[model samples]
Target chain A: MTQPLTAGVSLKPQHYADALACRAEGLWFEAHPENYMAAGGPRLAWLDAIARDKPISLHGVGLSLAADEAPDEDHLAALKRLVDRYQPALVSEHLAWSMRRGVYAPDLLPFPRTQAALARIADNVDRMQEVLGRRVLIENPSLYLPLEGHDLGEVAFLAALSRRTGCGLLVDVNNVFVSAHNLGFSAEAYLDALPAEAVGEIHLAGHAPDANADLLIDTHGAPVAEAVWRLYGRLIARIGQRPTLIERDDDIPAFQDLMAERERAHALLTRETVDA
Target chain B: MPDGFHDRFLAAVGGDEAALAPWCAGPAASAGLAVYRNTTAKGAADALAAQFPTVERVVGPAWLAAAAVAHAADHPPRTASLLTYGEAFGGWLTTFPPAADMPFLADLARLDWLWTGAHLAADAPPLEATALARLTPESFARYRLVLHPATRFAGFDDGAPSLWQALQPPGDPPADLELGDAPEGLVFVRPGLDIDHRVIGAGTLAFLAGCGAGESLAAAAMDALAAEPGLDLSTVFAGLVAAGAFTELRTLS
Candidate 1:
């Protein structure tokens, strides 16, 4: 197996050749495991070629950890097969639900953080870790609405789940910034309240201002904003240097554009490690 | 514990504006549920839409998206990974009231489903052309062939495959690419990770279906010729091997 990631970009098909050819120091690639979940295709082939060169991270967007039930067995089995085949350095899923009954919603859907919800999510995470046979990093989901129920705050809930299931955290700083802005909370407090030791990775991505609301949307469509870069720096300062990624899922810019953003993250991560 | 979080959440996601009113207090709160609902529906619809793009292109995004949402509601994903989510959508659209007029939509969905199946199938080695050439004519007659792990095919009553292909970039078809009556069959095989597809005629379809049923080459070819008389037996037999359709050859004693 490869070593842990240093700096990475979400591997996009358009940027496959560039990702393969680039020799940026400690740079790697991450992909949505769901996208490559095929029987056979060029997507898998490209990933194989890339994995041969750089460490890969299987970031799952569709694994609904907060669902009212255990993670789907077949889905876990499929993911385990990918883990076995690729032997990716890291595996992670979100702290949200996108599926229920038998239909799947592709977006990460939010749920009220309650003790019952925590127990259920922990069970799901346990199932995932059990199947994949490794510790997974559960990301803090971006909240869009502030609802009425909660047994624990988001940070506390994540902390409890990590303690119970032995999973670590994949803190997306941009999600923190976006959710904090949307739901009326301090992003710094949310990041600070997290159990620092539980964090294995951090994500820095761009967001778009919701045309309708005053809130900023976690749309990985644009370049990382200056505020998010500042937030990422603060996070690296507090959490120490973890594997940080620059995520751009939609309206993906040129490979160089992403590399430039990644370069910024790498510089910050490098400085934090040196300073620490 | 809040009294109706689950019920209200579901109602809000289902697009009932009033369901989220109790909890959402401010002016923009009504829009909050709308975002969640839109995001949820779009997620499911988009997954369906990606899987069934031909259907979407054939039926337009707005119409197919609405139908996809309904299909998702009936068969909400049982798993978190939505990669293989819409196995029931093709069948669901057949009975869908809006799609009742377009019988071909179901067939198009069937092709999409098979495409997905082929895409996700296990990897397998393709039978080499040299291996088939080594067989004696008589031996070839008795040989049973196994297809590649990712092999998938379906025969439609009309020219859906041609229409599907025509819709590919270079063709750039218009809204309705007039469905014709040429019976067509599609075969998707992944020798490695690349899913290659081709449109075959009645004879090849019959032969493939026979081989799929574990029939020997002679028997399968006979079945193919029977389906479409005067079918060039040599061309049909050679075509299968050339396409990397079958992955293994064996003599059934």
Candidate 2:
């Protein structure tokens, strides 16, 4: 089996065989646990075979930690099954809620960082940890519209969640760039202010410029921007090194292209570790 | 905090133009919220469309996308992970206005949903021929074969199954494939990381349905033959076994 992932790529069904045959060092894969949440089938079988040969991470997009309540029990149970089966090196979910009143909107939605919201999310995270029998990494989401009723900054809220639920942070530098630009904040300062020691992983993905508005959308469809790459370097320099991922969700290039991006991250992490 | 953050965030996401004006300044606010809303809805629709490609192909991407979006808005995913989302979409389409003309659309949607289920099913070993060889005719009468975890079959009152089969590889002009005016049957199973499917007849459907409902093998076969004489029982049984349908066997009390 491969070592715990140092640099990884999101596993797509279209590239399943390529992912299985890939030979990059310390190369790993991450998948949305929801995709494998089924009774019996080829998707689960493929994941089983891949997990036997590599370190996998279950990157969840649907736990809805920021929702008004805890995750659906069935969803949590399904997640637990994947974790148990794969023995993934990392398990992560976003700090956004997409399900409420039994209605799910398939995105990492934003919410005000109020004390109430923080407490509720922290409780939700705690429940997740308790059920999964392990700690998880909570990711920061890309924000579009800012709302009122805030009592904490994104970094501060993440730090509070880490402290309360023993969860770590998966900092998506691209999200920081996108949200910072849209909401008018310094992406550099946002990254710098993050509790670097609590950060367990990093995400780098592409974004698109909104046609109708002066905003950047986190489309994850293109190459990582130079600005985000530069910020990633700076974050790695400060935090030493973490398991970084190069995410390409849509208009996916070939596996080799993603591996090239992953190699860049691996090189950066290697340099930072050696320097440290 | 002017009001509850969750409530305000919901208001902002639901397109309350001014409630989030402070959060989103100026003319860009509505556009920005619309972007989020569109992305969220599109993400759900895209996953559904991918899961149900044959249905999308039948309905056309543009028309299906619109239907998927409206279907999603009413019965949004219950979990943040969209992999297992859209359980209600097939049923929802039966009542959708635009889909009314395509009355068989619901069955097609159900087939797509089953395909998704088969694709994501757990791994299981196919029943070995040796295991079957060990069974005597008397034992077979007492034994009920358990279907694989990934096995799914349906009996349709019309030709929807045949149309779906035509969409499979090696079949030509699935679009031109006519839905015959007779009840059809289908069976889907994944043997080794690939989903395999087949179109069967009335006897086979009755047999599988009887097996699914916990009937013993002999009883199911009797039921199948009763439904349609000359069903080539041995051949059909062997075909199902080869397709990785049965995973276990149990003796009925």
Candidate 3:
């Protein structure tokens, strides 16, 4: 806890043993709380064992905060239980909604950034903070199809939400890159517009170009792209160091391979700190 | 208004392209929507495959993946926790025309679902065999045993349980999976990190059914005896107790 927030990797069940045995300094782990919502099982047991020694972050992908309806109480209660049990250093969710009525779509579906949508999402963030008794970092969603009716840009919308809800922002650099390319915007300009002081954490993951289309898909199946790594360096240089995560959800390689990418981020963070 | 944004976006994702036309910056947006559609479908398909490993084994990954996509279109997940999704897949497969040749496929899917349930059920310290010896014969008659939270038992009229059990270990399934007329039972328990399952006899199945129904030990034994006239009640009960199936024994006060 004394060390600065260092680089970490998404904790996959396949890499539990390696994660536990990992000895890199300031190395921590992140896991999607939705995956561990079971009543009891080996998944929770493995997480408990890993949390015993390292800092854990509960990054949620299914809370559906942007849905028109209120956040699911059961999902919130389960998330609270995980946060209470694991005591993760950082808790985070997305700016997108996935559930409509009772049916859930696994992807982080987007919504227009209008004033009404902002008010609703801010209220959801407030409710989430009140229930968890802590502030959470809301992440930017990777854009696929651009939508109309938006009253604010993505960065402005995030900043406004932060101002209203007293929550922090998780700047996902890879999401910024993919969204910019797919939506015809400048990634650098988008990152620059982010309120640096409101930023509490950073996320770096992989993306692939669509097979039959020119759009970029946030696949998270491969290693962090070089372009994303460069963006990570640039963002850290601008905003200083924050806890960063290297996420790979599909086609997961060996634990050592992920750690190597994590180590690259760690090295950059260390160098940034030295330069400062 | 933004209130209409979600509805339109959802419609566009659901293939109502014209609904989101105003939102589309250009023609590139159409391909972008395809990415979302493909990703959502992949998510549901992956969850179904994970939940039903035995089904995947029987149908193979390619076949299962395609069926999963079709099934997901009809039955999307109701919760973000995909671990417990695909509850209706087993029954749905029974009506799937492709599976008409495999009558036991639905039963196999049901067993797979049970396995998932057992794997994720609440964890508790299992009861020891010594706990059972403390009860007097009179007390045992009125005492009801509580099965562990991870306990799952089911009876099959065909040899599906045996087929499912054989397919568990890594390798090609048996060359000849002839559907026999033998009625069998399977019991699943997760004493520790791993889920273990085994096939059982009709008497044991009846005993488990009675226990699950909160029947007294004496009554459960009677039911077991009736189910299999030559049942060794003591051995069957002792085996279940030794398997760490019971969590506690409560006397009905």
Best-first order by lDDT: 3, 2, 1
In angstroms, the error of model 3 at A100 is 0.8
Better of 2 and 3 by DockQ: 3
> Highest TM-score among the candidates is held by which one?
3
Number of the candidate with higher lDDT, 1 or 2: 2
lDDT tens string, model 3, B1-253? 3246677777888988778777774667788789888999899988988888888887888888888888988898988989899889999998888989999999999999999899889999788888878787777688988999999999999888989988876777887776768999999988777888889988999899888899998888888989999998888888888888889898866
- DockQ order of candidates, top first: 3, 2, 1
Chain A TM-score of each candidate structure, as shown: 0.97, 0.98, 0.98
Candidate 2, TM-score vs. the true structure?
Answer: 0.93
Superior candidate under lDDT, 2 versus 3: 3
Model 3 Cα lDDT, one tens digit per residue, A235-275: 88999889999988999999999999999999988888889
Candidate 2 lDDT at A173 equals 95
lDDT of 1 at A122: 89
The 10 consecutive residues of candidate 3 chain A with the worst lDDT sum are A1-10
Leading candidate by lDDT: 3
Clashing pairs in 2: A39-B122, A40-B121, A40-B122, A41-B121, A41-B122, A62-B80, A62-B81, A104-B77
